[model samples]
Target: MLGRIAPNLLIRIAGRTTEAGIPPFVDLLRIAELSGNLPATDPSSTPAALLTRFPHLAEVTFEDVVVPGPHGPVRARTYRPPHPNGIGLVWVHGGAFIGGDLDRADAHWPSLEFAHRGIRVVSLDYRHAVRGVHYPVPSDDVLAGWRWAASHARELGVAPGALHLGGSSIGGNLAAGVAKRLRDSRPGTDTIPAGLVLVTPFLHPFGAPWPTGMLERMRAATTNAVVSPEDLTHMAWNYAGRRSVLDDPYAFPANGDLTGLPPTLVITEEIDTIRTSGEDFAERLRAADVPAVVRMTPGAAHSSMSRPAEPTAQVTLDAVAEHLLGRWSPRAA
Candidate 1:
């Protein structure tokens, strides 16, 4: 085992690579050199470092805000565009409920790119499910962030009707829960998001059945990075603080009604173990008559969003931007 290396150590390793003008791909390779337990050529490179190498483009800028939360003030960053398109996103980043920050690649790059293209993004820094924090805490924080954004949409330069809620990985699970809570608790039309964007999400504790032989083919492949169903079950149990809470629909949206949810776009990585969870949840949404579209970035592994320099990550990011801009048509169910 590599043992638990301080995150700062990994950050330093990635930071040195970034300063040397090394490609993002090599940053993780250096980290993986520590042990075989770590995947060689993995997407685990800290995106916060790699992305800083690029020059800032356009007139996009960001502001830090303190939003009121159930526990206390929640930290958030808002990315603003020179021109507003009336679309805004309340974004969440993923770390399996225990880690991740606003600067993570999933949250930062997308917010910057979307803002450059004329959409505003409010990225949340919610409480993680660590140090006795559990379900409904992180959920409550996201709900609080959404409420703040919705109530101040005009001042935030976003149309109330066009504000969206979205997240990736475990963050997606949190976003889905917030959407469900708003649907059930608030009856007003303006409370819900215009649509949902879920990427490489883990929706089910035990994922839907894999496409026939898909699991076998993936395992046979040489990739050292893979997240299995058992891995997801462990994450769910940790977030819930107990096995029973997994049944809580708000904790895991797959356990609740899929009807009446907003139109959604679910993006998956081709070789990820969690791919089926997103795909299956989208189909369930469609079966419930909610408009849902699912797409897979070919040859992508999990955490593709973390490597923005890669062509596959670019495709994934474009899919989300297109969905928000209404520029791309959803694939037929």
Candidate 2:
């Protein structure tokens, strides 16, 4: 639609150009080639490359750090803005709950961005991947980080009562799970997040590899099918401990009871398979009397924010800032 609008017509025209009938499987092939494919698996190395690429990103400042989780230490980096902090964002890093580190660039970028907007951001580098320490384990570590942050909110310059939880991709999934748990725990009247900001969140695990009823969408599309069906099945089992896929809350938040979650902002790219997760969760949150909003970015794919200065990339960050600033308003309960 932007292609038909006013000036800047040429750029939109160029961006809009695509094979008229190219299969969506083409997207899967490109993503599959890169999704689980890692030339260097170290989390720090992954973000270091991005830091080298985007030199202008501000450096992260840590006022305090902690790794007090039970199973193992998860490093946390806190980013504090200049003045009295008005809001706090407990950010969980994304790595399919198996791989991530606060020392890495990807983990720091979002927090750095939040700090620049005057919100105190704590990024978590929780235990990941290995058996006995995944899924809800990561969720536990993130909530631990949040508890630590809340305890230190005053010293960290955060406001009297404003802490919002945020995450991206799988981290967002963990945050949603943790938020539900926190809601039920209800430690006290004053100990809970104000809202949730989810970016390209993977809210559902039951999404089939292909669209429903597509018997051979990729039969001839050799370039597609990232993470073979075998890997998908294995990941589900590994994530939820060998349970039937039908009733695993860890696997799908959309299928869970969301009666009391905070207001939520969920941004999804149309090209990602997990887009369904974001949309369904947002709608469900609203249906259950929780405030929620779903924002979609066109002409983009998942993982675009980690890439360079694409329009969608900046838009994604802007959405994060808006949520932190209390500019986002999901429907009130």
Highest-scoring model, TM-score: 1
| lDDT (tens digit, per residue) of candidate 2 on 12-58 | 32343223222132232232233321122223334555566555444
- Identify the runs in model 2 with alpha carbons over 4 angstroms from their true place: 1-56, 83-85, 186-190, 208-232, 244-251
Kindly list the per-residue Cα lDDT of model 1 for residues 39-127, writing each as its tens digit.
22323444444445445533678888999987999989998987879899999987667666776777787788888889989998788
RMSD of 1: 7.0
**TM-score of every candidate relative to the true structure:** 0.83, 0.76
Pull out the clashing pairs in model 2.
29-223, 29-224, 47-105, 98-129
Worst 10 residues of 2 by lDDT: 17-26
User: Who wins the lDDT comparison?
Assistant: 1
Question: What is candidate 2's TM-score against the reference?
Answer: 0.76
